[model samples]
Target: MQKVEKVTDKLPELGARFTLIIFLITIIMNWADKNLFSPKLNAILEDFGFAANETTPLGIIAALFMITTGIGMVIFGVIADRGQRKWITIICSFVYSILTILTYFTPNGIAGYWYLFFMRLVGGFGLGAVVPAIFSMIGDYASPDKRASTFSKFTVATIIGQMGGLALSSGFSEWRVGYLTVGLFEFVMAVLMIFIKEPKKGVSEEELHSVLVAGAEYQFKFKKEDIKILWNNKSNKWIILNFIDTIPGSMVAFVLFKYLDDYYNIKESDVLILMGVGILGGIFGAILFGYIGDQLFKKNKNARAIIAFFCNLAPVFSYMLLFLPLFNDLYVPDGVTFGELISYPEVQFLTIIVFISLFINQGNGPNWYSSVLDVNLPEHRSTMISVASFADLLGNALGPLIGSLVYQFISGRAAMITVAIFWFANSLFWIPVIRNIKADIENNKKILELRSNQLKPPDN
Candidate 1:
């Protein structure tokens, strides 16, 4: 029996250019997310004059958009695993973009709500297909040493997208501007994807079968087994880091924005500037973490997890700081027309609240997230990522519901604090995840390599 020579996962000579394209895709998708219904939310609410948190109808409408990303990704992940990325990427891009643009014409109040919902559902299906496919391509394209850094670029694009959405959605009091912005961007990106090519990998049915048997190929064989594998692998089991950290972040986030907007009495126009502060922080953090992650890769090759651990831990302090009235957050009330701190102490309070909020929230960036995706096996990359995405979307779906419940039972500071407590409890989940970061990365590589070879052609 002849031993197969191993292939190095180094960047192709044109790797920099390829990475740039991936970055653009990340930004576009994020823009689609940020702009979708958020900017129009307040306007829609005003138009409907519905009580706050009574947004069940729109929530359901918007949430339908996320469903496909969660449920659909699992199926498409399997498809990408089978090495059908070429067509999947192109088509999904088209679907996601067209649906996003359709958002512009959505009728306002109730009618507008349904339009956004329907388009989101279509976009979700398209989005469902692309993520895993991209990861699979990146897995093959990037060398292990530089992979984390490469993936960080994607995360940066995501941040840019969120920021873009922040700007687009918040740009107009009318919501049409946001819809147009997201729609045009998605359509343009879809058209641009025409020239980008990721050569088919393990492109044949036999090779596909070999990869699945070896755990490299996609499978239709959904079982308790798929999730079981997520927990069964000793190294993989620790991934609760992904699940644990993002929950707190997502749960109170929308409310926190409201809290800040209310705190500083910030107008719609300032929200972008307010959020932009965090985006700037993310840009700095990405550069810092990318540098650190690359260095750690040289020393330990599992730097992605280490960066995640540190990034996850940073929010703990930030969350607590917001709970403060004097020591941390100190923003003023929205409509107080008195002296700065004399006639209105609330404004002073709000000012402090936002400053800290900006400081603490900046931690949500590529520094914390891209590492997890970068380290997973390429074939299983989408599904593994979907695990994190699933946890997030699941939590994203659940968190706001809890916030609604809290608002019903409590009011003002108490309602805010109740959500904060729930957020803090999840911080405990990251500890186990971070402790074994190095082990998970190393084990994943070993497992995938041994299994991946089986997916390779006998000649290669």
Candidate 2:
């Protein structure tokens, strides 16, 4: 057996703060793409000469974008494992940014919908590529002990991006302006990313600290056979399969505002205010749970998954409070601003419920992200994340179409109830993960330690 050399120097911090800021902004822009058109769906439909009730076209467009995004995750994930992640991210960002700008030029009529559809389909690939690259870099930057908290910040960026997209698109008279604005921001980020340094693989692992500090590289690279190794990991199996949660999560995401409008006669402006409050809850939940997960991780390796299980279940009850006829008498008067809306006793009560539901629902992202990093090898992290994200993107792709069908055939209320049930079911998959996580983490550490011992230090 090989042995690690004595550490002669401290392992350098790899521009973690700067890198995180850039990646966080990238994540925000990528997620914003998902919601850019959603808030102004009616306006887009009207511009395209479609009937007010026609939503299938929009659903189809959303589904196509998700499908392409899934493909990009898998493709870019593989490439990121073997190539320079920095350049891959830059190129993908440029691709999506250009396509987003093109959306601003869409002509009015049914043709414009097709044009928008194509742009989304192609742009989604760019969006998909960024997920694996950013997460892979994050795994290297964040120490094992702090991964959940770090990951939580990125998850918060996702929520912020979602709200930002909604606000930007709806704030304007022309929905296309939102896409243009988002595209410009993405382009600037891609340019700035050129100067951010990529961290050495596995630098954050305690097992590799001595090796890296002694001026040796963690030289293991991803290989084709590693796919089997990844699939065979027990924790990876649960993580990949646990993507069912996203289906209902996406269902609610695509339709929640529309549901409010149809069921409660809530106006778009009022829904935005409520959604803003929900975002605040989500941000708070992510940060709080991220701290809780990190604290618990110190005590038990299984704590992250355990927290995730309960958090997933919490939303079911909260959604019940929001969607049920309990608030039938609550109404927002015309042109109510945020202050006036909150002043209403019933609206204030509804806001509390929204905040709570979103707060708990947001817990799953940070913990899940940390869980993926904890189980996979450094060389395999990008590919594994991509594979896992593909599963998630698939759910996102199907969610809108399925939600539309359910709402059309059954009723809006039935669709929401269905979302709650699926959300509950997402919690069950975590049991297997909680059971297997400890062993998997141990196995990963052992591999890293072995690799660390084999690394050759640079000659003086």
Index of the highest-lDDT prediction: 2
Estimate candidate 2's alpha-carbon lDDT, on a 0 to 1 scale: 0.84
Error of 1 at 157 (Å): 1.6
Task: List TM-scores for all candidates, in order.
Answer: 0.78, 0.94
For candidate 1, give the lDDT. 0.55
- Model 2 misplaced stretches (Cα beyond 4 Å): 1-14, 331-340
Residue 378 lDDT, candidate 1, scale 0-100: 50
Local distance difference test values of all predictions, in order? 0.55, 0.84
> Residues 312-414, candidate 2, lDDT per residue (tens digit)?
9888897788655557776665666667766767677778888998899888889999999999999999999999999898888888878877877788778
